[model samples]
Target: MRVGRELTIGTLSRRSGVNIETIRYYERIGLLPAPPRSQGGHRLYSGEHLERLVFIRRGRELGFTLDEIRDLLGLMVGKHTCGEVQTMALAHLDDIRAKIADLRRMERMLAATIARCQGGGRSECPILDALAGG
Candidate 1:
């Protein structure tokens, strides 16, 4: 929340908990606005840029795709209602649930296959055999 006339990219990265390369990548990808440069061609970020980077980093941490983040940003700027946001969130939730279910299924299958292994030597390995189309 440090309001200032100018801040270096490093300072902004430290304040926002985002790396400098990521900030530049976001700018290049249009996720963040390109900041003005100093007389020596160094990037000068403002407090607004800092907050926007923080927002983007948080969105990434929350597992949102860049495209989804872009849509959310649009909603933030446009006439977005709670319903729209809720719908998007619910869709993401469904995707997460599906992935969790798939992972649970895989875990169960792996556990069953491993349980068939007795750790004895010279015996056919059930895990390897199962993996080898048995």
Candidate 2:
């Protein structure tokens, strides 16, 4: 892509692999600075917009919330310390670990309950019994 090439929202969505509605939502939420428009009022996204969208998409893929991504983007715009970014990353890492632990616990319980289940013939389902107990 050219350095200054202007792209339509459709083209940007295709190029960045982000949905058009997502792009509009990002703009509305101020995650993305609104782009310039054509005389017809079509949003004309530039390379910068594409780059930012890709960045936002990657952040989302990595499980960052929009607010977290906003904080990271905040770092990109002004003078900042690597320490600040690292701190956020560390906190997010902790959150991921906790979620993984919870998921593992859930998996084990569900697997055990399913194992106890005799399957099709019996009306007494271990899964339902466990759910009822809770």
Candidate 3:
């Protein structure tokens, strides 16, 4: 959080805990604005860049897709977007719930299949049978 003055790309990467390649890729994908260059052509990043990168990293960690992140960023210009943001968040939460349900189902199936396994040097495997759609 020592994000005061202009920083090099390396400094930004270290400060934000995001890789340099990811920073460049974010710039390429329009998630991040291109930073200005120094006299010698080295990219000079402002504190705002560091903040934005942190936001992006957190969004990614929270399972927000890049396009959804872009939407969030676009909505940051005004307070009127709170309702919209909430709607998007709810949709994402629903998707997460559905995925959790699927994962629980998978866990149950796997556990049941494993329980059926005797595993006494048997040539037949319940695991293989389940995998083979049996």
Which scores better on lDDT, 2 or 3?
2
For candidate 2, the 10 contiguous residues with the lowest summed lDDT are 1-10
- Candidate 1 regions off by >4 Å? 120-123
Q: Per-residue lDDT tens digits of candidate 3, residues 1-134? A: 54568999999999999999999999999899999999999999999999999999999998999999998988886565678999999999998899999999999989999999999898999999989998
For each candidate in the order shown, give its overall lDDT on alpha carbons.
0.91, 0.93, 0.93
On the 0 to 100 scale, the lDDT of residue 6 in model 1 is 94
Error of 2 at 101 (Å): 0.5
Model 3 residue 82 lDDT score: 79
> Native-vs-model 3 lDDT?
0.93
Count clashes in each candidate, considering only residues at least 3 apart in sequence or on different chains: 0, 0, 0
Predicted candidate 3: what Cα RMSD to the true structure? Answer: 1.6
For 1-134, candidate 2 gives per-residue lDDT tens digits of 34477999999999999999999999999999999999999999999999999999999999999999999999988799999999999999999999999999999999999999889888888899999994
What is candidate 2's TM-score against the reference?
0.95
Ranking by lDDT: 2, 3, 1
**Which wins on lDDT, candidate 1 or candidate 2?**
2
